[model samples]
Target: MEKDRRSLILDCAKELFATRGYHSTGISDIIEKAQVARGTFYLYFDSKRAVFDVLLESAFETILSSVKPVIVGPTPDRNNILKQLRINLGRALAPLFADRHLARIVVSQAETLDEVAAARMEAFYAALRHYLEESLQEGQEKHVIRQLNTKIVATAAVGMIKGIVWTHATGSESFDYHEVVEEIVEWAAMGIVTR
Candidate 1:
């Protein structure tokens, strides 16, 4: 089927990109790995960048879908906000845990590809920041959190999470995602300063 072939190409491309890095991987490489003809690859994607773009978009979609359920409905109160945050963190990390390749692409490699790719990465962060900002605003309204600059707070939170995820994905190894999530949520909700 056409869809299956396209997916096959994408799967092969993702594996190549993850293993070989985007710049090192070429169109021919993708086709060969996919076991598809050159013309078949052209039919599905115009170029390597095109395939990378699609992969990045798909990863973002997965992240958005993962986080949507936790934050979309009723606002959480003080008692439940921490629990909600934990759920949100767990869901956010699920895709990355499942696919380190996708995580590497989104977190580190995309921006290095080109200006358009960099902008796409920026937009991805913006989307995450927007979601965090909305949640923080809702928390403020509910008097669950202190009055703060939601934009700055959201940006910082997203940056922290991304930094940890990137390090875990690309660094030496032995990083536990649940521990990262737990520490991040604890710090985000309760500051380091002791009372």
Candidate 2:
């Protein structure tokens, strides 16, 4: 019963945050939407910021779980590496596609909302960059990719994906996730420098 009520509050808060934007949405709004009393909300979460932080953390965990399988393994041959890259990109975007409103909130609204939010976003990006860097290093060691600066490549790859995903999420028109993943994988696999 207590768990259910807490979850109810979280779900209501997610909906409100997604629809109303964080700054505009009030604690009373979440309380009313959750059908819980003011005291009940406080019992579960001290403030709106607290709840939003939990939501952001939850989203980060979901993304990591989805992408872990593709990135954590022995480096494969060139063909298999490309295949795994496509899968990795696809899984990374799956959660965003599943809850686009949350994606919009995180991508467009979180950074400027508050210091806590901004910090959380920075931590999230750092984790992603670390993962990508490790994967790229493994690829380099196995001769799966050319010798290059793994740190720069990982940062650039993550930035490119973030830019495209943010645009696709916040855009007016829907995008094909599979096609986008294919294009991203292709670009990552094949360098622009003509050999």
Candidate 3:
């Protein structure tokens, strides 16, 4: 079936990209791995960049979808938001962090690619930014915590999470990720003040 073949190409491409790096991985490599002709790949995607877009966007979508309902649902409780973020983060970071080679260059490559990659990355990440902004707005409106700039806080929180992911993916530290995450949530929810 057409759908099955497309999926096959995508899966093969993901593996190749993650392992071989984007620039080093050629179109022929993907076709060879998929056992499909070069023309078949073109039918589904214009270039290697297209496959990268699909992979990155799908990863982002999975994380956003997993967390969207929990953030926007009836409960805007501060504790609930933290809990929901924690739950969804595992789903998002686990696979990506598990791959060292993939994580190293994945985020940075967007800026270096052609116009298509730049636009695709912008759209994907802009939506992510919007989601963060929305969740923070809801939390602030409910007086869940001290009033702060919601957009700034949301973007900062996302930045912190990325830092954690980068550290973990690079094997830079031996600290437990869950503990670091808890510390991150605590810091985000409440300023450090000795009780």
Best model per lDDT? 1
Model 1, span 1-195: residue lDDT tens: 999999999988888888789999999999899899999999988989899989999888888877853342364444456667788788888888777878888887887888989998899889899987887776666566678888998888888888877876685564687887789878966752111
What TM-score goes with each of the models?
Answer: 0.87, 0.86, 0.73
What are the candidates' C-alpha RMSDs? 2.9, 2.9, 3.8
- Can you list the residue pairs that collide in candidate 3? none
Least well predicted 10-residue stretch by lDDT in candidate 1: 69-78
Candidate 3 CA-lDDT value: 0.68
Better of 1 and 2 by lDDT: 1
Residue-level lDDT of model 2, residues 70-169, one tens digit each, is: 4434635566667777787788788887777778777877877888789988888888999988877766666666778888988898898788768866
Better of 2 and 3 by TM-score: 2
On TM-score, the candidate that comes out on top is 1
Cα miss at 10, model 2 (Å)? 2.0
- Candidate 3 residues 43-110, lDDT tens each? 99998878887877776666566564444356445566677766766666665566554454446555
Instruction: Please identify model 2 stretches exceeding 4 Å from their true place.
Output: 69-75, 192-195
What are the lDDT scores of the predictions, listed in order? 0.80, 0.80, 0.68
For candidate 2, give the lDDT of residue 12.
87
RMSD to native, candidate 1: 2.9
The window of 10 residues in a row where model 3 has the poorest summed lDDT is: 186-195
